[model samples]
Target: MEAREKRLIFPFSAIVGQEKAKLALLCVAVNPLIGGVLLKGDKGTGKSTLVRALANVLPEIEVVADCSFNCNPMNPLEMCDSCYERYERGESLPIAKRRMRVVDLPLSVTIDRLVGTIDVERFLREGKKALQPGILAEANRGVLYIDEVNLLDDYIADSLLDAAAMGWNTIEREGISFRHPARFILVGSMNPEEGDLRPQILDRFGLCVEVSAPMNPEERIEIVKRVEEFHEDPISFYKKFESEEKKLTEKIVKAKELLPKVEISDDLLKLLAETVINLGIKTNRAEITTIKTAKAIGALNGRRRVSLEDLEKAMELALPHRLRDKPFQKPPQMKPPKPKDDKEHNHDHKHDHKHEHKKEEKSGSARNQGIGSLEQNFRSIEAKIPRIESKNFDGSEFTGYRSSRDVSITVVNFPKGIPVSYVPSKGEIRDVDFYNSAICAVLNDKKPPIKLEMKDIRVRVRKAKAPTLWVLLLDSSGSMAVKRRISIAKGIAEKLVESGYIKKSKMALIVAKGNQAEIFVSPTKNYWEVLEKIESVPTGGRTPLSSALYNLLLLANRERMKDKSVKVRAFLITDGKASVPLFGKRIKDEIIELAKALRKKGIELNIYDTNGKGINPGISYVPILKDIANAKVCKI
Candidate 1:
């Protein structure tokens, strides 16, 4: 056996602050069955550093010497097929001991590369199954680290989470099946400012910890000093913490050994269930993960029985992200204003009519003063805003986050698209599918380099992903002030921008407030800018719906002229109130004409109706706008 090269790594014990993150990592190391941990926070918080340092503190494992899947030597059930077969035949498997590895999964990894691909040439030549192991294989019984996990492609992220939960990776492509154990401690670190994972994927993580840079001056200085020392003499700095690392490693080993023996009382189990229920977390994984984490904590503390403290610590790490708030609940109904009595009205008219007029002015002044209070409570109304979705997707490049199919055979001309499959060629083949060709030859019992027929050619089919542009037209008129409509519109806009970010799309904001509509944000890929701009948009003006639509059409046209294939979609958030006219025509006529013009230009439109019960019930022009513009409408 050859010796492995050693790399300099900061000691785990040397890390300061983030005590909760360190404990979460240790718990997972002690018991991988607790699932995995998600470390979410800002960058430069030592997330990646902690994960890499974790390797030195983990105990070594014994595996078959020549196995690619890191198959355990003594456990046949956990071994790869070949190793199990050899063991079943009374053959002694070679055993080797090595430290558990931390495998880094790159952001650009593809499905075939992640789950392993079959060796087509080998299969055709040898007439046997030969599996090419992937990252999952190497990570078995170890750790898989994914940095910037929130930015990972949704499909790839889903595959990883599924493999983590299932504890196995099964490859069944081209009528061949192979399986390998992929049980590993999945550690994913991400910055929340970049984006967020889907809720379902987020809940799959067994525990989560939020990390941030230390605010204390002393801790900050200490961190800076230690980093400088490490940079000055890496080996010397490592030596300083060698004893502490050794002690921690031994503690982890002991915890793993004690994990099985650690038991929790029935009272603790009931309490755990009650806590999850109280948190409004519906997933059973929450309860199961809490129990497992508590047991691991007890074991790590050298205790045989779980205590309340263990459970408390476990819940802190396990249930924060899983805590769900009731969303989109109907607000409390407002009471109607009382009508004045006829007798009191007549008496006031005779004597105190002037006083009544003064009082009425005072009441109107008070109502006008309350607008600032409504604006202050914008955040409170955000939870009640429902997620918006397009009623129809035109298969345009910007229509969805996933890749859209291009039916043109010219896909081979574009090298950027991923080649997914092969089909029989209809004409001269520009790109050949050699793998499928080899399979075709083998199925026909033909030898290698023995084919010379046109029918044997296969064309590669590719799937390409194109970026999308979301043009948001926000209605910031005074009418939106009623029922906190402007706040809800802002919330919906933020959500849309978030989706745009995930889809790798550009977002632009158009505010229809004041005398006329104006483009607040030009089309750009920086969704953070869009979100920030939405927060400060003030409301108190006429709905210049016509002007907003006109500006949108011009923007869409400009984008189209720049790139012929650019997918542009418009989202108009209004209560169908076109109070301000762009041209000399009536408000209704001008907006309808603009809507028709927009439709004729082939730009997609989606309307978000911010209409609700309020004192000023503006005329809803959504039906006319929707009919004329062929737009999809979502009522908030």
Candidate 2:
């Protein structure tokens, strides 16, 4: 909470390039009627910068002053219990409306935290009245920004899609509750090359824009100049845009007021629908978004008449993710081919064979009636096409027929989803063109194999044995609560256990505190129990780094004797700030001794040191921990 933090970002016009991306976002702002938009691009592409700059121009929100979940009092019907209580008590609840806010959804966030969990303190100490309001509740009627959308752990993304589409936030467990006004514009940004989102989620995005680095030279120069100017004097540069910023704010207000009048004529609507269908998009929602966004663009341009240009702008935003895309996205290319589908493709392929047979079956009288095909006279003509190399094995050269393209037709047919881009309409033609028709007609076709030979071979490589997991040594000292390290520790443990591992590997947890170490959950297949124990551990006590090492030795020794066993590595989850060096021994030597014992037992010790700020400061008692086991740090 710095004083200088609450300030306007650079004006949208001030952004150097990425005009399409900028326009797309602004249209949404003008008419939130357009649902949401995704800014797709790579790192350092100014996606985040452009998004932050949005705060300056987005319309403000009116909220109830004393409402914890910030329910809008003006919409009395939407107020929850707490807000309703104050409303009925006849107390004058102040209303402080503020500019719409952008809430950031960070990765590594736990389900309980992202979606509200019961207030344990109230449930335990006061025996009821659990508190609510997770990130969803707070994001009511605003924007929820998700960075690195592709890499978000799957479960969290599921919840996000649910809340966004349903527009109602509900937590079914612990109690039956409802929060109706939980709708928000979900702005997801990602580098598509990293990975792909589930198709189900991808279809939910109302609009999508692919953002790229500047390709135009003049634009590139402007980018450098604006970025440098902002860097040199961020505050002043922002200040200079204040007037332009205010002007945009006014424009947004005006646009919102003017939005309703914008119309989509039936003719234009049909065009929009045709465009969507031609693009191969799946849902009706895309059409709706395109219409709303087109109108928003018209409103922004100060025109009540929605033009084709406006529709084009909106269509670009709505189709990328929705459309199956060019190059036969429909079945032959659209859906991934299935096993049972091979016959379907073969059925189409057989027409080519049948036409060739018909040509051969012609009566001698028909052949003599001045209607001879060039196929019977191939040797008379000479054509030099690039000779395709043969694909059959040296020993099996006579085994299968090699097609003109050098593809071998084996006894086994290829399965579906494989496209035949070059099939012909006439005469057993595997490929044909108006110009190539005469040429292909002169080529010889191979006679069908009198007796086709076939065989089936299958190899089953057994799945690799599971890697063994060790214990997680967590610091439960009082200071952990102050730094919120305990929460992080528990969260990591949950993730590690949840990190699906094969049956061979096992996980355990050890809580070290006040001169003794206790095993919360033992090494076993029961991961749920381990997770439960981890979440239940209370943080407080002296750090007992020594005892935790001793118990780990016992388990490490037991695991070492097993064949191909992944040595259980203990993740020493600590702040790297331990107290009073264990048992009057030099801390370094103590760490080494523990590590040495582990190594002797064929186990490795790993210390996940969080340097106060979830940043991994490399192995603290390094070379020592290195001796017993490999040590690495992870920050989230």
Candidate 3:
């Protein structure tokens, strides 16, 4: 590594704010057996910087010299072939010490580039097959950093999942087979808006932390000044924090040695289980990860036994990503009270006496009302709120849902707003990604070639499918429906249009009426088209809800075939009064089957029932639609 490159990197200790993120990374360093840490937040929140700085802060590790997999010198069972061979030969193996590195896994990396593959260059030179270590091999005993991990190719992501879980990389392709220990701290950072990490990948991470830009003005100013200084004179800026970095390095080394001694109490373990249960967590992995993290934190704090404080901190870092966050519900922040002088303490006590007197007076009323009672009263009232079969959507308040203001839903898995390469299909060759195609060509070739062949050439492909397509299916059938429903549908359509605008999603409208579905407005970025069509859509026709859904399914399928990465969600605004179907005995039955099939095909459905209140809350057909579609149902 060049001095300039080393200097340019912002030191871990020097990073302002994001203390939670830094702590999570440090916990992993102390106990890499805690799986790994995931940093989730928006761009430019110092996630990548904190991850890279881990390489500089960790103590150097010993490895068998010239071992491709960096086999640990002390652990023979985990040694690579070369290391084991030398050990079996009773030969003295050279030991090498090196600083742990942050090996980057680029978005363009393929299976061959990630796991080991046949050495194409060496094969060409000697005409003999040899294993060329990939990024996983290089990352052994270090840190494998993946920035925008959610954007990684599905194939590469699968490899990571297996290797991460098994602590070994096993590859077999193109007449080459090899296995090597690949135990490393896996650090991944991503912006949730781009795409969600697949569940399997999400499960592999031991700790997940959400970071954000510092909200404090003073903190932001400090960040800006420090960043400016670093960019202006990286060497000078780094020099200022070199002492702090060394101190952190020494701390990490000590923590690792102390980790084995750290113990967790049964009470803390029981508390962790209760917390997970209260949070409605289904997986045991969360419990295990929390315990491991708490122990690591205890070790870091130089404690032999894990405390409640350490457990609380561990839960904070481990549970957010694993659990479904209830809106407006926040965990109790357990911050230690600041020390106060005698005068200040006396003032607080005086205030507490007055508060206690007021509380005592209110206690009678509270007792009468059974304020402290833990009964099923709230549950009964909530149950009486009428289970409208028309709606079964996530109840969490949409992130930016404001009735008096513009509305917005944070749509995930949306098409790339920019040049995001989620789909691993081949496209034009970019210089750096050419190696992937070259390796691919060698694998596909029937026989080993003495020289290159033009026909075997393949180019690297990336998904250019940017911007999601929102298909709105509106029901405008029957005279009564037209008079009572059109206006409700129109109002709902307007809200959805505003939401689409905020989410930067393309909108399309399909109106179903008179035994047919017509594309009122084609998919476009303009929200105005949705509003314009809503105002002039023809109503008072026989319901053809099935046909409308079928149409939406066709559109989704076309988009899926063209580019599987594009997110497509259909909003069905209807009273669920389908009197006609393009084909089938019962229109409702056909619609249910179609809805289920469409959902399976990856198009999400949200049913917005425009039916009126009281006697007829929602049509029977709505429940069937909700069940089959697995959709979020809402009353307009």
- Candidates in order, TM-scores: namely 0.73, 0.51, 0.63
Best candidate per TM-score, number?
1
Score candidate 2 by lDDT. 0.60
Could you give candidate 3's per-residue lDDT for residues 26-70 as a string of tens digits? 998888887888898888888898998777688889988878888
Error of 1 at 282 (Å): 2.4
- Please report the TM-score between candidate 3 and the true structure: 0.63
RMSD values, in order shown: 13.9, 30.1, 11.6
lDDT of 2 by residue, 476-510 (tens): 87666665566655555554454422122367788
Model 2 segments more than 4 A misplaced: 1-3, 6-11, 76-78, 81-94, 120-127, 172-180, 325-636
Q: Pick out the ten consecutive residues of candidate 2 with the lowest summed lDDT.
A: 381-390
Candidate 3's C-alpha runs over 4 A off are 1-4, 325-449, 453-636
Candidate 2: lDDT of 500?
24
Instruction: Point to the candidate with the largest lDDT.
Output: 1
The collision pairs in model 2 are 329-334, 595-628
Give the distance in Å from residue 116's predicted Cα in candidate 1 to where it truly belongs: 0.2
